[model samples]
Target chain A: MLILQKISQNKTLAATINQIHYVVIIGEGLVGGALRDYLINTFNYKFFYNVKTPWTDKTLIEAHFNELKTFIFEKIFNSQKTELAAPSFLQLSFVWSAGKAGFAASFTDIDEEEKDFHSFLNLLTQIDQERPAFVKMDLHFTSSAGGLFEGQSSVQEDSQPHPLRPYGILKLRQEQKITEWSQNKSYFHGVIYRLSTVYGRIRRGQRMGLISIMLQNGLHKKITPITGDLYTLRDYVHSMDIARMITSGMISSHKPHKSPSNNLQVLFGLSQKPTSIFEIKAIIEFHLKHKIYIQFNHTPGNARDITFGKIQPPFEVQARDIRSGIKDVLTDWYGAHT
Target chain B: MEGTLSVSTITPVYCGAQYLEELIKQLERVRQEWQSKNYPIQIVESIFVVDAAKDDSLAILKTISNNKAYPWIKVIELSKNFGQHPATMCGVLYSTGDWLITLDEDLQHHPREFIELFKAFAASSYDVVYAKPKDSVHQSLFRDWGSRGYKKLIAKITKNPFVIDFNSFRLIRGSIARAAASVCGHETYFDVAICWFTNKITTQKLSLEDQRYINTGTSSYNLFSLLSHARRLIVSSQTKILRLGAWIGIASILLSVALGLHFLYLKIYDPEAIPVRGWTSLYLTLLFMGGLTSTLLSIIIEYLSSISLQNQGKPLFFMVDRSSDALIQKFLNHEPIDH
Candidate 1:
């Protein structure tokens, strides 16, 4: 068991009295990986159990979830005994940032994704049923802003979910499941983060973002075919910013007066600025210091301009500027390739 | 159906809850129509700026926008009722398209007419295209006559030839539209500001009927609003009407001088023709004083008009790129646009 204490040099982390006993991350994809990194480095949490299962295989996935439930039960039981020996506050967080489908996913793919999501929800029910009385549970579910509000522009905070594809429908369904789960538990604090188009460093075997793909194609001197036209707009937020927001949200929720509640708080994770594909291409080209060829395929149904209105959420962090972020990603890519 | 040209349609909603759904449905049809015909143009987004309606228009707009089918519907809510021009300006600034078409929320301007507007725009080197009503819009003869007569009279008075063509149903180049919107102050009339940017404006004849007025026998613009609009338009424009005052004053001074000369001739050459002892002198003095006052008032108005123009943030010059006109031309010519 790794007992991690706050470093004295890091004043911000040291100042907070948050004692998160356990954090179970359900996914290890781009967003989940970034979040885990933040928790270990910036957030300074050592106890973590990463839940990974083949989302497509129902039997194996269910068995894996059962094991996860047993793991959590034993850990909490031990932590409770330790709390009696030394009086302290304990917090348990379940971060669900997993998805196996893209916006252009087929119906079959979405169905499998939906099944995996249901299994995860079942596990949550099991944990909620047997959880200790004193342990506060904070559930953070990652929802897609692009999927929920596809082809929409100037999406307000109160705007309804208008999912275009099956992938979007699945995301909405997952959010509904989490909302339903949190309804009965008074100790359950739920946060649904509707993330806009997320761009970041691409990990191997994971889905690549437009910016990352553009840089990759540019490096290989290959022409990238865009399914959307130059004028298509989207709100892109970096994944690290999403991590910061989620951590901040958890910290804010644990304050004395701001205790756990059954009612789920919805927050839009967005940059609040709509960037056009043309502008993005220019930015990439400027950073790459070369003109990259892009052919606009613009598949008729795939081209939808999704933009978000200005929303200042309570847990928002100062978002990294798109230009500098792109530059950093490019530099990282260049370093790795070289 | 994808094309190089993109268009954004802006509608300012105020007490237009009844017609909004039908308006959106009609726009959808036009969107589908364009896509089916491969019209080399796409309706990128439809922006509805709700200017704080007294009714449940905003709620209905939200409901309509959230339907998943109309994902391109963007709603902008003002803090309070900022009137139509400001709301329209807000929509224009939010728009991200190659061209912008502004229409009423009352379903008066049918979305199908956009084809005609687009055709006219593509055929000419115009920056703005206004849909000219083929017949009566209000159905009431008096109202129609009044609307036309007011526009013509304003056009003559202000010497703004485009005033007669200033219909709410208009297609403006996106760059020009946004640029015009950016410089607009609180009281700046939107159409007047547009005129200051580019004079390449044309009109397309279309059959338009104000369905709301026809059904309800009332218009969004009552007599008070129209008058207010006229006053704003006059104020926003560099009106030649002010110069008319100076011209009239000069004519008066000249007339008074000629009359004074005539009176002097009568006094000197023909003494018997004089009706009274000092009548000629008194009349000449009054005429001269009246002319001087008129001239002084005109000069004062001239100074005020200059100040008003400056206050309105009238740009010294505006730069626009008409390079996309070639694409529209190709589209109009039925040539393949992708190449």
Candidate 2:
């Protein structure tokens, strides 16, 4: 009964934002880490991401969100420091980049990620319920283009998502759940970003995309397994470019033209260049000055081509080309390792 | 090919350093011509696949591609030479357009003729339109005759009537081109693999000249490479000749059986009707053994062909969207196209 009342109260809050005080990141993986780095170092924004907390654990996740709430409240309400110009309405921006499932993930793994996502959402709901009536909350969920649009060619903004695997289904469900969770809560603004094949940055213990894996393996002269055909096309976008776009979107006060009834903006993040594995291999080999050993073992998940068209305006950001991006990534890896 | 429809031009480069500059110049003129005319068509990208040519082709291509005058030119340099067909396939796989046009690097196929190819493709419901040379491509009787004879003989052998019409200068529907290129294996002939998807192929006659061949009496194809091309084409095709062999084998077996029965009847009824002493037994034995060998060989060949096709990644059904082609047809017919 208490939970029901809290949910009902949270659903009715009006969304009016004048300023943002606290920026929080839920996941610190590839995209999350890049976003966090950009916000803290580049933009000098007040971004909070707790690495020690296990977000997937149901019991600990609630406590983690509570701690985050306390941290934000202390920084915004208790402190004299002004994160932003003093305004009547203060808002909180949450960038949810927390997903453990990938294109090749099993059903069990995807199910676990879904549960983690729900727990995270429940915590957000709790925050909304307990927050002062003046504060607004915005969420930016990083969805997967490779998953949601797998087996699709020339994917446009209006293309209907037909998820072929559990990973894609989970992504689609997350998008729907976010929409539902923020429904009628004008105080909640949601932006769902469907990102294409992201590659760059070699972080420890975090999974990397094909480009990174090929570069890392190339340095060691290790044989890389090719799971897709040589001609399978994909749109590759850099992680930093994603970080830049998300950061700009979060900071910009410009809202979409859509009605505030839903208060949700769905955008596709892509480079709009459909490149093939054969081309990618050639580029990498050219940059590395040595042939990267590859063994072809086509997988069901990557058997089809997933190419994205030009992203719509107002949400589009210039993405780095694959050739120069690969060069930069390889050079960075080489500098760090050798 | 339609309102805001994009096209990509691909050239497989191998020892054409001298012609790269002129080729780019011509392509640029075409690109400008299309833009100024506003024919609802755009040359979105021009891809050059450098097949690790033995000359200065790669260097020249890189320099020209990096020039600000031709920003749409994309140069893909392979680590090693993968031959012309593979290089072209590599470029096709990288292309993102509604239509794809492939030509040679030596400027044998003029960029001006691109409009002719487009008119041909748009005028019909064909997925592939080849720019057939109305005159001799090399203007050398021996060379032209050899090329024609080669295609004719291969077409007769493989029983694919479209073989004689295949040319390097072609305009292929982008989807079919990419699909075919995607399925091409190391041994799969790119043109033959493309035919597996759609049979809506046509040809447009165009006056073309091999300037390099005429200037230097040398061409990209030599005796060895021509043989290799023939082998690859035949291997990639499901030759009807093999089926004919099987039928012939069965007919021979039936005829041998009839003759054996007749010989037995003659011996039983009238021994004097037999002209030779052991001719019947010898003749039947040879005929039966020959038939059995031919039948076994044909079955083996058929099984091998099926396995080869499967390994080549032949798609069961490829979906194509011709809605854009309608707009292209309207534009060609001087009808107003909706933006």
Candidate 3:
């Protein structure tokens, strides 16, 4: 009877501490790192990252879940331990798994591709199932706007994705699963950020982008072969801008979840306008103050190599100028080399 | 001819944003004049290779290219500032016309005089024609004299009289220009590469003005830039200069041998005729050593020169398109040449 009464009091205390929100980030990579730093520095939200492993050890996965559960419980009950007050809302941001290789792999690797898909699905399932039961859990997922709408010139939140590659197909499937799961639950609120081509300083073991490759070649004074033609255009956004948009969308009072109309909202996260490969090369060369020798290969054309239309982000955000962004990246690279 | 021949004027721009507008205006005027006069040639495109200028030259060029009135204007922004010659080669590679005329972006090479060069090519049946200024060039006296002296020296050394006629403002057949540019390496002087392909070169006299020099009282070529040009010119030429070293070594050795024999003959005849006791041996030793050193140095120089030429993509043999001459003649006469 005494233990039952204590449980009843604990439930009342948990409801009182529900004013504070906790954000759990799944992947800690280039975009994830930026988003994690942004959420902590801007909103002072408590941050937790999922343990990264190959998922071969069931004991390791269970231990990780137990550790996360204990951390969340302590944050809710022991408010005096941390610098910030107890959490009211819990926001979970997922930004992991999948890259260019998933798209570039041939049909002969179907089995491997399927394995990758299942691994991602299983990850999401585990997260959804094992989330803290004491608090209201909000989810934020990042999907690729460029990959999903591969050959399409212009894409919007409502545009039906006609994915051409396996990577895009897998991304679309993940989006569908998240959307379906987010619906039919009043307590759940989710935001899907469809990101454009993100360019920034990639962390170690992170997926490399064109900008990073060009900058690295320029710094080393090496020749960089262009796989695409001069006219291949891409919409580039700084990773920090995406992080800021995600955080701002979460904190705003008129968020998608707060709306009486819909529980799930999709937003595009694009910073800079569309730029071509030729223009990007010129900008990088200008910043480096050296000539980057280029040899054009005779590779067959890719379907996604078409020019992109103007990008319209969901909200207004300060976009960094590409020239200065290149300068900053080159400067950082020079620092590292030196 | 299936259609009238088209011409492209390629200008490599570097810190010439201030003069770009005026340059384009003059080029447009020349194009309009050619069309109105019923000339068989049309200025199809005016390609400007912007060599990553420090100024706002690229933005100005973008504005001009975007304007509907200047549809023929095509701007190619290079990855970085490759000097004037490489930039010109880049423009040449991008050109698509029957004839390509390269000029400076400073408006010193007037577009109005292109007709004279075309006429010169028609009359002489030459593959390339250079526009030589008839009047005193509007450069400072020092630069003008330095340019003249340098050209004369290069002509004398390389034994190629065509070096004297080389100028920035020139007309070349598009096919040959692209071919030469393709084989041009970082050290290859563009005009010297053209010379390697053909000796059929001529010059047309035109009155010219340098408005930029007249207004600013300073030319872009400094002492260092002049030295760099001289180095490229000497490197691109055949190793005739090194051959001169070998000839000198041989001549000295022959002369010294004759002198030594004469001294020995005199010693045998009469010891009283010797000027000093040990002077003959000392002089003989010095002559032999000097001649030997010169010979060895010349051989080393020849070997190094061959290596450099190979690195510069000097071909053992190249085929010239004889059919282009017939096309040029047809374009000149405004009638198709019969097969």
Please tell me how candidate 1 rates in CAPRI terms: incorrect
lDDT of 1 by residue, A288-328 (tens): 66667888785755666676654665475867766677887
lDDT of 2 by residue, B146-260 (tens): 9999999999999988899999999998878887886677888989988998999999999999998899999988999999999999988988788888888888899899999
Q: What TM-score does each prediction get for chain A alone? A: 0.91, 0.86, 0.75
Best by DockQ: 2
Cα RMSD for candidates in order: 13.9, 14.0, 12.0
Residue-pair clash count for candidate 2:
3
Model 1 per-residue lDDT tens digits across residues B1-339 = 234567889999999888889889999999988878767678868999999898889999999887776767888889998999999988886776778999999888989888789889877779999999998988999999999999999999889999999999999987678767766777889999999889999999999998878988988899999999999988898777777777777787788899989878888999899867987777777877777888898889888888787666565665565766887788788877764
lDDT of 3 by residue, B1-339 (tens): 133566889999888989899999999999999888656677878889999888888999999898777767888788898888999987876665668899998888988889888888887567799989887687667767778889999888887788888899999976567657756777889999888767789999988777777788776666888789878988988757678878788777887899999988989998789968897888887887788788889999888888776566554544343334555567667775543
Deviation in angstroms for A254 in model 1?
8.4
- Whole-model alpha-carbon lDDT for candidate 3: 0.68
| Interface RMSD (Å), every candidate | 7.8, 6.9, 11.7
User: At residue A266, what lDDT does model 2 achieve?
Assistant: 86
Task: Report the lDDT of model 3 for residue A62.
Answer: 49
Docking class of 3: incorrect
After TM-score superposition, what is the CA distance of residue A318 in candidate 3 from its true location, in Å?
26
In model 1 chain A, the worst 10-residue window by lDDT is A1-10
